[model samples]
Target: MSEVIIRDDLEAMAESGLLSDYNRRRLTAARPTDGAMLALNINLTAICNLGCTYCFAKGGDYGRITGKLNEGADVESILQFVKQNAARGETVRFEFFGGEPMINFSTIEALCWRSEALGAEQGIRFLYRISTNLTMRLTERELELFARFRFTVSVSIDGSEATHDRNRPNKAGRGSFRAILDNCYKVRERSDDITLVARMTYVPHPDSSLVADVEALYAFNIFDWFQILPATVSRELVRTVFADAFGDLAYSEICRLCADKVDSEYKLLGEIYMLLFRPGNRFRGVLEIETVIRMLLEGEVANGHCSGGRNYFTFSPDHSIMPCHRLVGEAEFRVGAFGGTIDGEAVAPWRLGINDTPVCRDCAIRYICGGGCKQENFVATADINRPDPEKCRFQFRLVHCAIQAIAESDAAFRARRRGVLRDLFVSCGRPTLSSGRSEEVPAPDRLTHLIPLLHAFD
Candidate 1:
């Protein structure tokens, strides 16, 4: 029988997988990062509308974000960063993120104008994007600016009104669902490129309600795709609607439930290219994300999804740069700031990828889970080595349920969606395609859900 392994020994085993010195030297010699990476998130204001308890900024605490807001990064400060990056021959893409980036629309506009002029002067086209709460008022001129500047907006919507209002209530404890829907219509009216990224924070009890939950968001014309975030409840947040589900089920279960009902969309989105992201429909939402997963492990990621701890940094409007947005407030967690550059030697080491953390270093699942969520690690203070095993359970469950869903569906639709997902993931498994140019990946239809894991078993 295979020997029963323990966590400590598993860590040693993980390190054992590291390349031999000779190979290490060779891979390092490749000068891996070919050119300057594209894009940087310039967070204009830390202020936000609805203050979710787990918000990385630890919102509403002026002390938490000592940095000033309501102020734009002077045209000079932003211009300097852009020119320097452009000089390095890297095309610049500006992303405006904030407590509610819309709150700082004034600053975003300033940056947009400057970015356009700068992009033209340098002969580099600037890419723009925004993530907002939608309830905040936005003007036609603002919509026009996005159209003119070509801002790809992702408005956060949490599933149906009950689910949304339940978890994402406003400061006054009223539901913000209808407000978001209203804004979404205006956005769709402006352009099809506007993406409504529905975010569902799961509370454990609603398994049966999953399908309707997903379908409700689909009713919103602009909800191009959905993003599923594990619902969080600090002790203080327990009084709200999602309080019980916080750590009740594994993340794998969350994924499985998601996969079962809306697996195609949620699972596929997780695997898309981080940089130059484009939504895929050729992928009927069934695509497996192996290539994308492998790509992230290989250190290629965009939009902060696979930060691997270095490419991007999250600042609490005050400028305390945490490794990324995922792990914002924990005291032990803060890395550096807008006031300081991360230590070159340490940045790579501090990266959350490559089984670097102690928990990951010893984990048998590190290759698959990759130290789990970077922020979740912050949630596990004393024992980051003990990854939130709940997530593992959730992933596995999502796969099982999604496959079941496919089984239950009309064979024809399932086959088509599965085929699309299969083709996309199959290509990703190939080293050539998975490791191809990192700028942007042409998305095929979302492929068969869970094909990536099925491939693993095979």
Candidate 2:
């Protein structure tokens, strides 16, 4: 694994007033008051066809007994919930999620049509997105509905065939790579209007190579964008499946193993940096890299880890509501029900900004890191406010890479690619200077000094 050198100079710059001008402004920026875009992750079913090794949802049932959403009552409750929360002319995003949401395709169809009708009546615009494995064949009607709704399809395929097959196998222990690929092509052939995102999960195994996996996936040239995320494996989940293999292993050891996987991301970062030089490079903007770059370019900082527990809430198949989809099985995270009132106090902790976390407040890259993922933090440390040290190290490295990319890129290159880069950022759901600002704000002068320190990594 690559090591990040936390130089004293960089720490000093953050602690003192040198970097505070920009950092403080970002730290103090008001959080969005009125929730403009309310994202509701409707967990259609707890049942999935595939049994992933690192499945946090515990074989698609979220560690609970198998259950699926009721197309009738559940659909009605969801629509009612939206009506209560959203205002007229406001946009409500229904993100179809599950073990494999395709298991409840009927529910999806019903909800989409019903929600569209409701939107028309109430003057509320509704948007749709689905996170599916793409192992199932979609009917002509399903394809038409997706194309008409312009649904953003996030397909969960882990890079290459070898990696994907190993990480995600069917219940019968068979490879699903071929089926998923065929379905991907089918969906792509259906419509150019639908946005297809290749969501790759990086599992830390001895045989796994992140760079090779990404290259194989990119070669297909089927996806419009790529979202790569590290697999979050809890000790309980590991013990449940591989107790005999990991019986004597400590939780700390498992965390160490996963933390080491950050090196793969570091390697991929180098690939992304190189792609910047290639004109019309489709693979240049990975979601992770583009997010940091977007923040740097727009002078924006995250008030929290994500919209979870705030505007973003997950509705489980059992009618329970949780702060995040990852915390679906946990009872403590449950703040409300489908048609019940949400407990504001229960969700407040997740609303904490980066400046609010004591551990993150002193970090050099606190503003950029946004205290890491709250769910990851809660899983690792059993506390939402505290962050995993290794995760913190990874964030620091990522932020440094973003700074290096901006500092090293020539003015001519930046000027030529500014428009393209802006579009990439916006597509990733981040607002740029075009949102309100008339002119782009130049990065702080102190950022230049860190470029020399960043060279140590090279």
- Identify the runs in model 1 with alpha carbons over 4 angstroms from their true place: 1-39, 51-56, 60-63, 66-75, 85-93, 123-125, 206-208, 241-305, 326-336, 352-369, 381-386, 395-458
Off by over 4 Å in 2: 1-36, 237-251, 276-284, 407-458
lDDT of each: 0.48, 0.70
Candidate 2 lDDT, tens digit per residue, 14-41? 5443343444444456553221267788
- Predicted candidate 1: what Cα RMSD to the true structure? 9.4
RMSD over all Cα atoms, model 2: 5.3
Q: Give the clashing residue pairs of candidate 2, or none.
A: none
Best by TM-score: 2
Candidate 1 lDDT tens digits, 1-458 = 12333343334333443212222222233322221243456555656668653454455342345333444444455566456545533455555666667766777778778777776777776667676777877679787887787666656666788777766677777888888888777876887555444545555344435445656665554554454554543444444444545357665454355334443434443333221122443112312233233323233221112333344445456555555554445456566655455555534544423333554445433333334554454464544334555555544443443444434445443333222111121211111112232223222233233222221110
Candidate 2 residue 369 C-alpha distance from true site, Å: 2.3
Candidate 2 residue 241 C-alpha distance from true site, Å: 8.6
**In candidate 1, how many Å is residue 157 off?**
1.2
